[model samples]
Target: MTWLITGGAGYIGAHVVRAMTGAGERTVVYDDLSTGDAGRVPREVPLVVGSVLDGGRLARAIAAHQVTGVVHLAAKKQVGESVGRPLHYYHENVEGLRVLLEAVTAAPVTAFVFSSSAAVYGMPDVDVVTEETPCRPLSPYGETKLAGEWLVRAAGRAAGLATASLRYFNVAGAATPALADTGVSNLVPMVFHRLTEGTAPRVFGDDYPTADGTCVRDYIHVVDLAEAHVTVARALRSTPGLDLTLNVGRGEGVSVREMIDRINAVTGYDHPPTIAPRRPGDPARVVASADRIATELGWRAAHDVQDMITSAWEGWVRLHPAAARA
Candidate 1:
């Protein structure tokens, strides 16, 4: 089936495109290039330059490509930015999804895989967060994602569209240096950027109840996360009207202190991290229980924390050659 992948030129989107194409699935990339690099898309895939907010453009691309399935990944996804610009976040993330869903439901698209986030379960207190966990999103970004899922489900039920929402945790690493994440918004790249500038990485807090006293999170390899998308996308293609909401994570928690230590080791740097005050709304632990995804699709993450840091560092060095010397 020919699938239309929105935001397919971004880091995670690019990985999903490669994984789907590598598995012999036909895909067409739909990106506005606001934050995506057109070069990330493969030469073979047709790149449609458009935003999800544009229904006419979306419908045209869907029809032009004879799209049967869609993977919606285009959205504004910064917690701090979302807090500062709630309207922009709601418009881009929530309203964009509403428009896309309207277009998809109107078309012959049967399968949809939405890019959800663990942030939907903001400040989860449990050791391992399950899908049944109460959703109390802290930031507007998380609220948008949660609302997006609700819209997808409602639209899918109304239109008989098969759908899956994969709530991703901390995604890191890269399949290739060129395909690696270039943005410093994430933890891995943030540390890399600090090290390249000969400064210590800052840990948010060290007074938590955890062993390391720092916030704990579940970090999943981008490759594995992309594979989960492929698995879910194919599942929706095969199983009609199947609705799934599963978490894509390693079922393992890594503390901020430990991650910084690992990053230091992987990058061959001895710089110690500076302890800072805890950021507002930061959870002590937000690990996922991958049991649902594994039981539903037999998918599991293969890469470890070391794999994530090492590959992420390689990509950082490629972008900043001086980082290698540092």
Candidate 2:
């Protein structure tokens, strides 16, 4: 199937494009290059410069590429920013998704794989969050994802389009150094940044009801997450009118303090993380069940936390050469 990967120039999107192409699938990248780098896109894949908000461009690109399937990943994902600018998030994420759906449903695209997030379960009051967990998003970012899922599922039901919404857990690591995440929004890079700066990584609120008194979360390697997208994309292509919502994770939880310790060990640093007051709305634990996806697709994460940290550190040193000697 000829697939159109929106936001394919970004970190996770680039990984998805690589994995899909490596699996022998044809792909075309559509990105606005806001936070995505065109250099990250493989030379073989055609990169279309456009926005999901542009219906005309989207329709033209779909027609020109003969795109039979789509993997939409372009969106504003910062929770703090979303809280401050909810309107912009809704417009970029939800409205953009709506416009893309309109184009896809009108075109010959039969399958769609949406990039959802665990944020939809905002501070879930559970040990392991399942797909069936009640969604009560705390931030505008999470609300946008949940709304996007609703839009995708509803559009699929109405238009007979096979669709899958893969709710991703915390994504880290990289398939290669060139494809490593450049943003410092996530915990892995956040810690790496602090260590590189010769400062203690801040551990928010180590007073939670847990073994380490810190928040526990599930971290999935970006490579594994990309593979999950390929898996779901193929499944949607094969099954007509199939609608699925599954959590992509390792089914394990690691405390914030434990993760910081692991980061120190992998990066050859002995600096301990400093404890700070817990941020409001921080969940105590938010791991995935991972049973439904495994049962349905026979896909399980192969990389462990160490593998995640080791590969991520390699990429970190690639960007920050001094990080290795420091």
lDDT of 2 at 90: 100
Worst 10 residues of 1 by lDDT: 276-285
Whole-structure CA lDDT of model 2: 0.93
Give per-residue CA lDDT, model 1, range 1-326, as digits (tens). 99899999999999999999999899999999999999999999999999999999999999999999999999998887888899999999999999999889888999999999999998887899999999999888999999999999999999999999999999999999998889988899999988889999999889998997998999999999999988998899889999999999999999988898999889888789998887755677899999999998999999999999989888888988878854
Candidate 2 stretches with Cα past 4 Å from truth are: none
- Evaluated at residue 83, the lDDT of candidate 2 is 83
Task: Report lDDT per candidate.
Answer: 0.93, 0.93
Q: lDDT per residue, candidate 2, 90-191, as tens digits? A: 999999999999999999999999999998998887888999999988889999999999999999999999999999999999899888888988899999
List TM-scores for all candidates, in order: 0.98, 0.97
